[model samples]
Target chain A: GIQVEQSPPDLILQEGANSTLRCNFSDSVNNLQWFHQNPWGQLINLFYIPSGTKQNGRLSATTVATERYSLLYISSSQTTDSGVYFCAVARGSQGNLIFGKGTKLSVKP
Target chain B: DAGVTQSPTHLIKTRGQQVTLRCSPKSGHDTVSWYQQALGQGPQFIFQYYEEEERQRGNFPDRFSGHQFPNYSSELNVNALLLGDSALYLCASSSRQVGYGYTFGSGTRLTVV
Candidate 1:
């Protein structure tokens, strides 16, 4: 099983601020995804980026597969962005995905 | 299309009791995987099912088991539940042959008393 690590276990910022969350894996991955778990506990799929970069609204993510790491960027953050952001990856062809502990973000208005 | 659907958004049971949770994968998805997310912790994989068969599993015990039906719907059963069994159970579905990630459900919150 591949090990996944997320930095800045927690974060807090004022509304409209920007922040970056990082995730590092121990092995090469075939699948990589970023997720936002809202206060209600629903995992909103952020991005499925095995490599390259992608953006959705004020959020974007970049994955460097060769380096076994990924980054999620939140610009002009809002209160609705307060929740846990998680990074997960699949090491092999098996359908199982390993998840990092996540970085808890709180944006105060 | 409808995303992954889970039943009984919340549940409470006493220790030693048995419980069952259900999940329906997204349309056109043929694989289902179960995960347990404890409070203040990341989700841990439970097991995955494809074609009505258990394919891969995690570190859970036999007390935690699951079944997948012909339609790709699935059920997770826990026997003699303990307080530690309390957590949010998430169901994810994917196209295995396509080698893509998964679309997770909102999850079922289980509280074992």
Candidate 2:
């Protein structure tokens, strides 16, 4: 089993601010994804970056597979971005994801 | 196109009782996965089904079982539930390609008293 750790357990940012969240894994992974869980308990997929970098609107993610770590970046943060951002990885054939505790982000308007 | 849809947005069960949760995957998706997310915690993978078979499972016990229909819909069954079983159960659907990200349902909140 792989261990996933997220940094900055809690973060508070002002509107239009920028922040970065990190995720580190203990082993190699074939699948990696970033998810946003809103206050209403809806888990939305933000990125599926096993490697390289991807950008979606004001949110971007980069995964350095060789280093076993990934990062999620939020720019010009808005109140709607306030939620829990989680990074999950699938290590091997099982295809089950091991998720980091998550970084709780609160964007103040 | 409809994304993943879960049944019974919320539920309440008693200890020692059994409960079932249902999920209909997104259109054109063939795989369904279940996850459990406790308060203030990230979602934990429960199991994944593909091609009408259980392809992989997490560290969950036998009490946590599931079935996937030919149409790709799925059901999660918990027998002899415990107080610890209470959580928001999420259903995610994905296609065969790894690049195709998963679409998760809003989730069913289950409370055991």
Assess each model's interface with DockQ, reporting 2 decimals per model: 0.77, 0.65
Candidate 1 residue pairs in backbone clash: none
Model 2 lDDT tens row, B38-88: 898888889999988999888899999999998999999999999999999
- Highest TM-score model number: 1
lDDT tens digits by residue: candidate 1, A1-109: 6999998899999999999999999999888989999999999899989899999999999999888899999999999999999999997655588999999999999
At residue A103, give the lDDT of candidate 2: 94
Task: Give me the runs in candidate 1 sitting further than 4 Å from their true place.
Answer: none
lDDT of 2 at A92: 53
TM-scores of chain A across the candidates, in order, are 0.96, 0.97
| Stretch of 10 with least lDDT, candidate 2 chain B | B94-103
TM-score of chain B alone in model 2: 0.97
Q: Which is the leading candidate under DockQ? A: 1
Determine which window of 10 residues in candidate 1 chain A has minimal summed lDDT: A88-97
Alpha carbon lDDT of each predicted model: 0.94, 0.92
